[model samples]
Target: MTQTLEVTQAAEVTQAAEVTQAVERPLQTAKPALGRGLLLLMSVATGLSVAGNYFAQPLLDLMGRELRLSTTMAALIVTAAQVGYALGLMLLVPLGDLVERRRLAVSLFGATAAFLVLTALAPNGSILLLGTALTALTSVAAQVVVPYAVTLAAPEQRGRVVGTVMTGLLLGALLARTASGALSELGGWRTVYWVNAVLMIVVAVLLRRHLPKLHTPAGLRYPALLRSTFALFRTEPLLRWRAGIAALSLASFNVLWTAVTFLLAGTYGWSEGAIGLFGLVGVAGALSTLAAGRLADRGFVQWLTGAGTALLALSWLAVGAGGASMWWLIGGVLVLNVAQSSLLNANQNVIYALRPEIRNRLNSAFMTAFFAGGATGSALTSIVWVSAGWTGVSVLGGSLATGTFVLWVLERVRTHA
Candidate 1:
């Protein structure tokens, strides 16, 4: 009897060990904690990627003068980058799963740097357009690095981690306008490209050193991979709804930017240097991005969605009230950016919660739509600015913001039902 009892006890202990080992293995494979310095490095790289994409925005006027292009033609410089970025998201970001992410990031950095140089050297409008397109396409390194950061972070801390990275990204977007404007005024528009070229070269080197080797296990075939991207469109109703809102929200954001520069420069006789200061005030929005992320993590996702949407709506509504005063315009711009960034962070937090394996692909799809809409907004702004001026631009932009709110309601209804 004693011998039988001993054998049974041993068997029970062995079973418990097996169960514990099964649970431990996955935890072991999870990414290690990211140090503060590494997070900061990622932020800087992301910021540069954002800044590079916008180098042509504030300089559109200079390009129009130098290249003998129309307003619509000049606007292409901004849209072309958006188009290229969309293409990269569609074609390149998914490879995060098939290749070593670190190598992929470095290679993208190099390609983007090369394109920046080409942009600096372009002798005519066509060559410049080509270089801008290439630079935008290759700037997918930002997408690569961001998702890589998400993967490396602890799941509980993912929102905060992503928020920090986005703060950097938003700063880049804001400062891009200021820096590009200032540099263009002081040294000519072409100087913007020269500056970007040098910065990208430095970013590539830092990425090579700071980012750890990232391994991605292959899970699907090429055709299957493409199919998976589309599947998100079909299967995830919330993603679809939120992505639509994102497109419209971003459109509103871009419309303001693409037209405001021209309006300030043409009507107000503001120099590039003066116009850049608008971006300084816009930097206040970065705080919203961080706040939204923290809010989402605390299970206040619904509240964030509501508050952000309301703020966006108010931003557009303010334009109607502030048509002539610079103070009002500045206030509206700051509010608009804050609302957009907050909503963006909240939306991304929700999407990231859906699937861990396909986060990269998912980001690509959503960001592609997000940027494509921005291109459309910019294109529309150019045409509208030429014909109707600031009033017309504001009317169009306000309508887009209102549309985003309607979509937000639809999302809320769907979630409840």
Candidate 2:
């Protein structure tokens, strides 16, 4: 009787062990190494995709003048693009899990090319706004490429791979304005759209030739996939928390950039050309995301995030002083970029680690939250800049940063508890 009982207990233990091994085997299995060429190509694809939303920012004045728009009405062009991107993040990015990612990405670039032409050819403000919105609506191609990159990378290397791609994404945002400014100066604002139209086709061809096709389960139907994303907010605590942090961090980042333009134009009387160069300054911070990605792999994610949020708060103090000193503003914006990039990378690392299969959907949710915050910050800064000026804008941004730190601390405490 004793021997029979012992044999049964041993069988139960073996079954549990089998279950554990089955789960870990996938993570332990060798994943193909991502080639440097693929990484570079992916980076460029992501950058070009994201550049669609930002191209109009520097060209807003030119566009407004051409479209016969009032100042208040002209700003909507940028807002329309932002809103379109947020919508795409929610509606379109989830399709990555359902379809072949390479196809989806290539298709997005092609569609974006069409819309860019529409924007370039727009005869009036309304049509131009529609074209810009459609371009951004399809340009969530960057979001598609990012999660696809994560899937191709071995589990251990996901952080570094994601970081490298993000560098391109950030650089695209930084450089697009400069390029738009130059193109607009040489030709007209419409020239920027025409150039990007051709560029998007080139990008699509490059991506189609190089982007890897991963073997994922056939994805859910569209509605279920999207429904699953919002359900994630309820089901996954980490996703919700990370999304909030991203939103807050992005909100603070937007507030600074939005208000800084006013400070340069109003206080320093800087030309549009000079004002455009500051985007270059922020590129330094974007480059640091690669290091931040490596650090995420080394562990200490929480520490890195905590430090970033703290710096974000502290950077605001320097930014607040920018009203008095140009050096302070330069130094502060650089610090702000570092803090923002690092924190965002850390947040993605954490969320991406949570549920591997639905990375695109998870990303869709995270980025949607992020853009929503950006839209908020843009709207808020416009109001504050008018009522309180630079000082008021600084205080508002600082308070948002401080709130970000507090949220980070509370999360850490709660996680530990």
Which number leads on TM-score? 2
CA lDDT scores, all candidates in order: 0.80, 0.86
- Model 1 TM-score relative to the real fold: 0.86
Off by over 4 Å in 1: 1-30, 60-75, 184-190, 383-392
Off by over 4 Å in 2: 1-33
lDDT, residue 347, model 2: 92
Give per-model TM-scores. 0.86, 0.91
**lDDT of candidate 2 at residue 94, scale 0 to 100:** 87
How would you encode candidate 1's per-residue C-alpha lDDT over 1-417 as one tens digit per residue? 999999999999998787566533433454674678888988888888868888887688788898888787787787688778888888888888667788999899888888988988887788888999999898888888878888888777777778888888888877887787778778898888788878888888887887777665445887678778867889988779878988998888889987877767775788767777766877788867777777777887778777877888788666655557777787888889888888888878777767766778888778877877777887798788889888888888888888888898988888899
**What's the lDDT of the predicted structure labeled candidate 1?**
0.80
In model 1, pairs of residues that clash are none
- Single out the weakest 10-residue window by summed lDDT for candidate 1: 22-31
